[model samples]
Target: MSLIPVDEALARLLGDVERLRTEYVALPDALGRVLAEPVTALRTHPPFDASAMDGYAVRASDIATVPTVLTVIGESAAGRRFIGHVDDGQAVRIFTGAPMPDGADTILIQENAERAGDMITAMEVVAKGRHIRGAGLDFRQGEPLLEPGRRIDPAALALIAAADLTQVPVVRRPRVGIIATGDELVEPGRLRTDDQIVASNNFGIAGIVHEGGGEPVDFGIVPDDEFAIGETLDRAMAGGCDIVVTLGGASVGDHDLTAKVFAAKSIDLAFWKIAMRPGKPIMAGRRGDTRFLGLPGNPVSAMVCAHLFLRPLVARMLGTSTTTNIWRARLATPMAANEQRQDYVRAIARNVPDGIVVEPMSVQDSSMLKSLAMANALILRPPHAPAASKGDVCDIVVLRHIT
Candidate 1:
């Protein structure tokens, strides 16, 4: 089979995918979830004309001049309204957030007025509507506060609550099942022989799943046997997993059994090879309603593929937008011409006096997990690109958000 470009592979993988179902969750628990429907204001904010500052509610004409004396009628604190009206030379002591008393059109801040027994003398001139928050100043009833497909961040949660919504309609999070294959692989903290290596791709992939808003269900390590791999895949399907991610055992090598097992289980294999460095052997397919992704056993390869493909898939299922987080940066090191496969060069990015500068690691091996860990960005190099020198502009995908 011919190799598929990275972009084409992703297009095919997500071509038929759709957003999952919606569920109602409490506002407090809606953080980081995507809104399934728009949230409209249940009632107008500041439902009544309220005070915006601690001051005396007086008729604008009463305080049009400095040092004007007015009789204090009653006090209006938050949650308590002054029943009396401010007529002519009368005023009402009002606190912030308190409703304005009847017949009051302006507020004279306490600092601008001197208070005595049942009386206040305006010390400065004031205009109409000063310090008064009109009804629906922030939002009006039936107005849309948030739209669908919007992620509920801290600010969004506060806005939704302010809209008088105790419960929010949000898209249900996708559940992903992770299966690691290889007889030579063992769980972390377990004793390993000279021929065995601790399995780490599952943990890393699980973290990616969580960060992408999906629940991860680990199936443990399955040996190279075909039956064991098939059984685990069946169990994951039976468990109602939306996506099934298999690490290692995807290549055409004699020991690679993931492809054969998936085919034996009647999986509609989509594609197997991609035109990308460190992740060329990645495979994608579907069995029933569960999506399957087969990643290379190399630690760095699996992570790079996950960031490029799996993250977007999970986000799509959650009804949220996915971003590449790509930024422009100046290359701090020289690079040779790229081959047919696109390269994701792990690099360190730093903000300098001029601009953001990125330096790719000297070693670009697929199995080097330490280098991947130390990297803060991935310098993107397109296939068949010409050689580049230091100080050249390049595209970089940020791994962590910088302040």
Candidate 2:
């Protein structure tokens, strides 16, 4: 009858979270995936000490005087090394990324040199290791280049490639199956009476699962009959879904049969009825390989709970650190006194004179989605919170990541 405490609810919801086994995947398919193993360098970067610029490799001592003259020994371009050692009064013409000649320790820019019939003369002096990328400049063979749980990006992929990795071991994407229930709910484009609501929450939840890095498969909407819900759950399990999310009928009521259905399916109950507004009726459990999440009937409640619990579950299964840290901003307007429960108030953040301030949307109803679209963040209110003045720093959950 009362709201659950946020901390206790989080602990209970997170208790069953576990990572899946790892598998080797090609680099191209590895983007956005969490690494399952530490990525160690297979070979030294800049395998051979090489130039970092188009210049002439010369001994620093040989360019001690103004307009110093040195005979060009040979040319060095990328992948074309001039293995000849440099002698006194001699330089090697080298291009960017080219391996420096053996005896040369410094480089003089071509702009600082004058070409004279197969001979280039040094004009300015340089120091040792200058304009040169020494061996292991980026990474060394046998060194840990990336740790497990690191999310792969373009830069990371490039680094892996440079490490001579044709593929990488990564956590598998969580397969999330969505089942929407409610006789009044229908799919988009379907003819519906005024009493019948469009079954949009399931699709939206599926999309949210994808945004959270899980693969979502929609099982469509089912009538409020016990057999229909059971059938959908069966289909979800047969589809090899790691998690089955049932929309609506999660609370205690005549029509709320999701929890019963999940129980009948022999799911080990995790937790239900969190101490959070808009989504207090959320339920979680597990049936063998299938995890179950029963969301509230309210649309906004489903989304908020998805962000709070479902997203983290996916991240855990994928072996990535998960937390909605969008950077806290101040509240633009004073807030009302909160009840004994955590609240995720949908609000829009605007760049006002003070700073980036979040103002709660006028419509904070559980069923409203219009206000959700206009909101940039969800401001979190601690349980039994008191009314606060403007400029109170608060935690926010962004629909998108910034950094």
Candidate 3:
């Protein structure tokens, strides 16, 4: 009904949110998914003491002195280990990842040894266990390696695989239905009258949803008609969307019918009109299990709202941390004071010698998509803050990595 602070709005949106259902997926499909359960090692890594280099495995005492000749007893390669033992003054030709032969405590790399027939001369002294990977060097069987709520990245996937886990329990990706509402908006590349503009918010919102680890279902564009918007909302709810994102028609205007349609569906409006610039008209609600977010029609406003609200919502649903990328930076130029609403000024962030310096774009109109695209950070100005001069440090939400 009334405007609320951005932090308060976010708290309401995710205060009681719970993680989605868990599903077991193969390791290959687990990337980017949050683990719903801890992953334990099924088998010990390296199973046994293995050589880490391609050379001779001998007793460290035997190679304590250089230029020592030792009789080669056997050869050990990956998967095919030498079954014999290496007695004193004896060595075993070993390859990387090969199990070290019994009685061998170190490896003399081939580069540091000269082999002639069945004998090899150690050219350099190698420490005991120098090139040998001890049993369970990485992890032991039944040891917990990955904890719950951990997102499966490339390294996590590899770790799971190395732990002998073929399948992993991960939070199911939340299904997000994205709808664009406006009669003046048309699909991209479609024929449009001078009064109509191409729809772009849905695509950007969908990308944000995906980047947040949610599956985005595009409901296409709906006209300003209440029935059309209501029908789309019904379909999204029926389709079991965990979250429904409506692009545009959030403000109370003649053509704004999204909120009306949501009301007809008995959606419990959480809060509307946050005390923030660029996205002041944003609204959030929920009906049954499907949460709804009505973002401003302006492209930049919708995107910023998505980053601030939608991203955290998805992360919460995935049982992961909802930390944002806010950082501190010094202002590169002077900035005017703000009013009651907090300002998110899109700007270019540069890595200067001292620290990160942000220069606000000259024009910060919410409707300008080009400026939003060119921005790598958003300077956060609190409500009713005083004007700031150059070099004043301020908190910023980093949109892109500062280079």
Candidate 4:
């Protein structure tokens, strides 16, 4: 089969994806989860007219003139109301958040008033309805506090709490089953032979899944045997995983049996071998309701592919809008021309006076994890593009903050 373009492959992968089921979670647990239903206020905030400052509640007509004397009736503190009316030439001493006295429409701040025993003199011309929070000032009952598809962040959580909502309906997080293949790979910090290398792709892919709001389930390592790979795929499917990702064994090598296992499990292959560097051998397919992705063995390639595909897949499953943080940046150094495949050059981005300036790393080998770790951005170069100068502007996908 021919290699698929990046855009076409991604479009096909996310075309008919449906959102997961909705579940209710506590307000505190709803952080970072996408809302499945609108959050409406349970009750009106500031159920009654309250004081916004520590002052005396008086009639607007009474404080219209400066230096007017008024008798102090009673005090209104938070959770305690005066209950009596403020007649003409009378005021009620009130603290912040206290219910306003009946017949009182204005507040005379204490800074502008002088108190002597039971009498207080207004020193300034106070405006009507000043320093008072009217009923339902924040929000009214039955009003929509947040819309569906909104991700609950810190501010959203506070707003929900203030609206008296104890729990919220949010889309369930997608469960991703990650399996690492190849006999040459061994778990980190474990004993291995001289020819074996530590397995690291699964950890990076799991991190990417978590950051994208999905729950990752590590299925451990599978050898080069076709039976082992097929059995692991069956187990993942039976475990109710929404997405199954296998690290390594995606290329056309003798030991590459992941694709064969996928075929044996009756998976409908969408496309394989994308027209992108470092991740050309990537494969995507689907078995029943579980999406399948076979990523390259190289650490950098696996991470880059996961960011490009898995992140957006999770977002689609959560019923949230998918957006990429791609920004334009000036090149700080010259770059050679590209070939038939598109290139994602790892680079460092810095904020300059004019705008963002990006400098591509000298070494961009797909197996180099150190360079990938140090990179905060990826300069996107189209297929068959010409060489670029030091000051040419290019699109960059932001990975993290430079600092």
Candidate 5:
């Protein structure tokens, strides 16, 4: 029952995800993986100096003096370029995205020009290089655009396509195993007595694993016997999982045998019992290459610990280095005091005129999963803190949508 500071516990959990490995994936499959190397521009954008509007390309000197007129020599549409250069006192009728002819230095927008037969008049003065997209304005050839460890998003994928890249080097997803322990827990569809509870925490943890970019292998529920716990863990480790999460029995109850099983399996305890509410029984260790996490039985405690621990581990596994400790808007309603441990209170965020408004969920029992279902954020209450008034800002955790 040793107590440890939250910051110190987090510090020991640092490093690359369980293991880092690189793989070549197509652009479409690189959605959330980290970029192993920087992406470079293959060619200059706009290729050549081009018009930015549907107007006339002319020498600035010809239109600088307001109310100037010039004869239209040629036309340049999108696919068509006016090969001939513009001579003095002459202009080229060019559409947007069309390359500027050799002798043109500026473009007068169509709204500012009046046409009379083949000649046009500028109603206002125009400056040099106006309404023109210079070569490589968007991107330059040989420029490093994206760096390693950067997560790939839709915009980034489009940028890679624009750079003419078909494949990218990204970190691979790690496989994780989840096990729930307790005689009181039964399978989702199993026949149960009133005293038996549903084994829902593993499913919640599996969804969390998927959200964190890892493949979850659920081992169902293991009984309270030490042999049953050991059997479940042995299977997970032998199955080659990168991380193993065993829910419940992390506390020192008569039936709490997760720690004893871990010792038998040669797990080296990294740290346990953080100074946080709901998850004070969290036990972290390592056995061989597999990272071990033993969480408490209460539903909210297990899930919140998963958000704080497992999610980050998977992100690191994918070389993302993403930090999930997030922000929450000031509370619109007051909250109660906290005990000696940090408490995570589930809350909902709403849109308001000034900014997002946060409201704590009415039912905050540690054993209730329904409260977390309607929650968008979790408000933090520091140890030994008194009750808070409305408008008090606090730390939060944003739960991502699980696919």
Candidate 6:
């Protein structure tokens, strides 16, 4: 069978996926959730004309000339409003955010007005409606506060609360079930034999799921047995997991039982063996309502695949419009030609005056987790690409979401 192209495989994996059901959650609990409904203003902001600065509210005609004296009849501060009008030769002491008094069309900033007991003298001419915020200036009633599919951030939460919303409708988070399979694998912190290694892929995958706004459920490690794998798969499905991810046991080895177990369960296999290095053994399929994804056990491969595939899948499920942060950068070192499989070379990126410069790590082994951790980006090398020299432009996907 031909290996599926990377782009084609991803397209197939995300086929027909829609946003999860919407649920109303309290404003405090809505952070990082994708909005499912548009939030509209419940009431107008600045309900009445308000003062934008601490000053004297006066008629524009009265303050048309500098050094004009007027009697201060009353004071307005924020919540309090001056009921009396500002007729000719009259002024009201108004602080910032205070409602504008009746018949006051202009404001003379405190710096431009001198006060003497119940009297203020304008020091400078002021324009009409100056230093005053009109009613509904920020937002009006019935106006859209935020659109659907917007991820609620800190500022978004504040805006929603200011809109008089106690609750917001957001897409339900997708639940991802992760299963680790390998007889030679043991849980971290447990005593393991020299030949055994700790099961670490599941934790990394789980973190990716969480970062992508999905709830990750670990199924623990199942020994390399068909029955054990089948039992764990059944439990994950019965537990209402939307996506099931299995680590290891995907290759055509005697110990590999993931394919057999999933096949026994009659999973509708979409594709397997993507045209990419380190993650070529990836398996994708759909079973009932839950999607199945089999990832290679190599530490770096699992994470790279998650970055390329799983993150976007979870974002799609949450109805968030997420795209890979791919950017162009100048190569800091020479690179050999790529073969049939596309390569994701771990690299370090630095912002230079000209543009971003990326330096690929000397070691490109798939088992090196340290290199992957230190890499902030992955340089993309397409199949059959020509050899590249230093200072050549290359495409890269940023790993960290730096603000």
TM-score per model over all chains: 0.97, 0.93, 0.97, 0.97, 0.83, 0.96
Clashing pairs in 5: 17-317
A best-first ranking of the candidates according to their lDDT comes to 3, 4, 1, 6, 5, 2
Identify the runs in model 2 with alpha carbons over 4 angstroms from their true place. 1-3, 351-355, 401-403
**Per-structure clash totals for the candidates:** 0, 1, 0, 0, 1, 0
lDDT of 2 at 36: 91
Clash pairs, model 3 backbone: none
Q: What would the per-residue lDDT of candidate 6 be over residues 1-403, giving only the tens digit for each residue?
A: 4798899888888877878999999989999988999999998886899999998999999977778899999999998788877788999999999999998998999998888899888999999999989999989889998998998999999988888899899999999999999989999999999999988899999999998889999999999999999999999999999999999988888888888887999998888899998799899888878999999989999999989989988988998865777999999999999999999999999888888999999998998999999999999999899999999999999997422
Which pairs clash in the backbone of model 2? 4-275
lDDT measured at residue 147 in model 2 versus the true structure, 0 to 100: 93
Across 1-403, the per-residue lDDT of candidate 4 in tens digits comes to: 6998989989989998899999999888999999999999998997899999998999989878788999999999999999888999999999999999999998898998899999999999888999999999999999998998998999999889988988889999999999999999999999999999999999999999998889999999999999999999989989999999999999999999888888888898888899998799999999778999999999999999999999999999999876667899999999999999989999999998899999999999999999999999999999999999999999998999954
Predicted structure 5, TM vs. truth? 0.83
For candidate 4, the 10 contiguous residues with the lowest summed lDDT are: 319-328
Tens digits of per-residue lDDT for model 5 on 307-376?
Answer: 8888888887777765875765678898878788878788887657766667888888889898888888
Name the candidate, 4 or 6, with the larger lDDT value. Answer: 4
Give the clash total for candidate 4: 0
User: Could you give candidate 1's per-residue lDDT for residues 237-279 as a string of tens digits?
Assistant: 9999999999999999999999999899888978899999989
TM-score of candidate 3 to 2 decimals: 0.97
Worst 10 residues of 1 by lDDT: 316-325
Off by over 4 Å in 1: none
CA lDDT, every prediction? 0.92, 0.85, 0.93, 0.93, 0.86, 0.91
